[model samples]
Target: MRIARMHLNESPFKPSRLVSSHVSKYVDKLNLYHVEELEAEFLKKLSSYTKLPRESISLYPGSSEALIALVRFCRSRALKLVSIWPSFHGFVEFANMEGVGVDFVYLTPESFELDLAKLTAVGSRSKALYLANPNNPTSNILFQDKDTLDFLSSRFGLVIVDEAYFEFSGYTAADGVLDYDNLVVVRTFSKAFSLAGARVGYVLTNQELSEEIGRYTALFSVSTTSLASALGALEDIDYMMEIVKKVIELREELKRDVEKLGLYALNSKTNFLFIKTPTLGRVLARSLSEKGIKIRAYNDRLIENYIRVSVSSREDNLRFTEALAALLRERSTVG
Candidate 1:
């Protein structure tokens, strides 16, 4: 049986044809280091796309690199990383590796909503706040109101908002970057733009913060090919929008289908769904893997019964639902 790879929240569709064509032009020039002109052009296009000043933007190989640089910068200033519990695990791991202290304000269980009171209580202890809008694992937008985001921005010394799934969520903190000098937004082409392999991510913030974070990143870290891919993606925004629309539709369909099987599916704003499984997540994940389907399961105590699966094409989604149904039937029979 063919494997249905739905663990990682990757775009099911291939990138726009323009991305391939643009990368091809860089093949012969790989022998030479990428020129400043290439970087300048990429920034110009990105600035136009994001509607932010070019000075406010900085490029990196991936958003993870940009995030790590921010973590190191926070560490230098003796700031602890504060975030909601069960967020993107990689960011917390990065902080631990850098010896930066970390703190978490747990979301309300089941609903997974942010508790403002708990968050405020930690303000005195934490100077740096990292939030993944439409949070990972839970796949729900934590702060939907502008007032709350503004309050958090004012409370923290630095606030980094990861908008990796912005295309699907239709929300962004990038617009507030100039309004709040402490606000920083990170975006990537990996999901909606379908450029995971290209490794292009960028930061949006005030010019000063942008430059400071850029200092931590090495020079010319993004390859010429990746720049070309990002440029092409910007040129073909409509294609990316089309892909986002389809993924959102499929995500909703999958959510409904899973709910029909008597499982709880979190209302997701990203390309993946966070499902509350009837059985332990590990057992469900193992069973699904046996049927050539792969998904994400958490070992974190609070979310041990949850599984995350990326929205794929209709056929793959059907396969997932069918396998899940069979497992549920077997479990019911055994019970």
Candidate 2:
């Protein structure tokens, strides 16, 4: 049987040729401590790529670590965290570990869109809000414009926007960090840049907040190879976009294919699609696993009957589509 691991939201593409070359050149530096110059260079490249001021951005091993740091900050300050339900589970889990309280604003059932009104009603009472634009498991962009930023800006709390899928969605809150003192944007190179193993991510906010967060950033957390690879990825933006283009093409094809199988494949701006199954998601996940295909199964109340699959290469997508079609046909005939 063919094996397809589509559960993790990792890019099917590898890092750019330039990135590989850069990492190869630095292979000998594995034993030495990571230096500040490479970190500075990567940040410079990031600032140029994002058009944000250098001082406003801080790098981390990955967005998860950055999020952990933010959660610690929130915990220390007794900041009440608010987020959309069924979003990324990391921060909520971290908050739980820290014993900080979190308020969840549920999404609309059918559209899976953010309940801005409900969020607004609760925003003033919370201290920080986490908005995962192009949210995970749902794969939908909450807004096309800066409406989210504007909405949260009018409220009292700080806003943390996680744009881990930014390259695929092209919607970002990085610039909003400049416009709103209370806004912070977190991003990762793992998805589009194809550096999941390297574990590189960044946070963008005002200079004061950046410095405040800097105090929590551990020294030498990022390795030298990771820094060089990130720099190379930044230098070859076109290569990354090309891979993103291919992923988008395959993602649309997969959406249509899954819909043909009678599943509700949500429109996605990210490199994955969320499919609502006719039966329980875990049951469907088991059936797919029997065919040597893996997908993310959700158990949360809002997404209990849905499965999320990362968009893979053309061949892998075709294999998954075929396997799913066969499985659905068999189930229909059995019924």
Candidate 3:
């Protein structure tokens, strides 16, 4: 049995003409500067979108590196980290490598929202909390309310919100950073900005803490190409929003389509949608792969028989339908 991995939806669109023509041409042609100035400019532009003070920003190679740096900082202090489950798998790994204690609060599959009561016991002992606002894999969204945010801020020493999918959701706790000294919001260009290869990400916190993170982070963590691309990406804010708008529309359409297939979609505000299929997940994945379509499949004990498919354009969606439909029919014939 051969298996293959596929990316559902990538940056659907190519890099803008402005990025190719204006900002990057000079550097790619001949002149190149260190990423410091580029990072500074990009962060300055990012400040306009986020409410946090610009000086509170730390640029990184990407969200993955930034996360590792965070783990290092918490490890140095030997603080316990508590995170909700059904998150990016790296949370568990980060805790283990740093030798920091970890606590998990698994949300029920039905609501897929945090259990506030269950978390009350956690923050007091929690030195740092990691969360994905519109969580990955399961794609459950939370904190459209105040009580949970207030409870977290009051008790936890640090509450980190990974809003990598915020561009699609139009929601954030980055503004909460203004009110709560303990809040840190992490964002990336990979998702919405279509700059995944650019390896650009930034953290929003107070200036003092930002400096501390910078001290621990790689000095030239950002690449000159990434810095220029990010600046160019930010330059066309309307185009970014247009891409987000299309993805949101496609995500809803995908949810409806999945439901029609006797599968349920976890409410998603990301570029990807999680679909539940009782026993056909692996089968469907294999079938799709043989047909040249790719997506992520998940079969954990808690979340058995499901796959995450990125919300692509109409053509790809139709191709998925064609492949999956054939697979289902073949299974019926075999049975």
The best candidate in terms of lDDT: 1
Error of 2 at 111 (Å): 0.2
Total backbone clashes of candidate 1, pairs 3 or more residues apart or in separate chains: 0
Per-residue lDDT of candidate 1, residues 1-335 (tens digit): 88899998988899999988888877787887876777788888889888999999999999999998999889877777898887999899888887776889898978999888887888753489888998998999887678988888877888889999888899887888889988999999998999999999999999999998898889889999999898888889999999999999999999999999999998899999999988899899999999999999988889999999999999999999999999999999999
Per-candidate TM-score against the hidden true structure: 0.97, 0.95, 0.91
lDDT of each: 0.89, 0.85, 0.75
Can you write out model 2's per-residue Cα lDDT over 1-335, one digit (the tens) per residue? 77787998999988888888888878887888976677777888899888998999888999998988888787666678888877888778877876777888898987999887887788773478887988987899987677767888778468888999999999777878888888888999999999899899999999999888767769888889888999899989999999999999999999988887778888899999999887778887888899888899977767878889999988888888897788778878999
TM-score of 2: 0.95
Any runs in candidate 2 off by more than 4 Å, and if so which? none
Ranking by TM-score: 1, 2, 3
Model 1 Cα shift for residue 207 (angstroms): 0.6
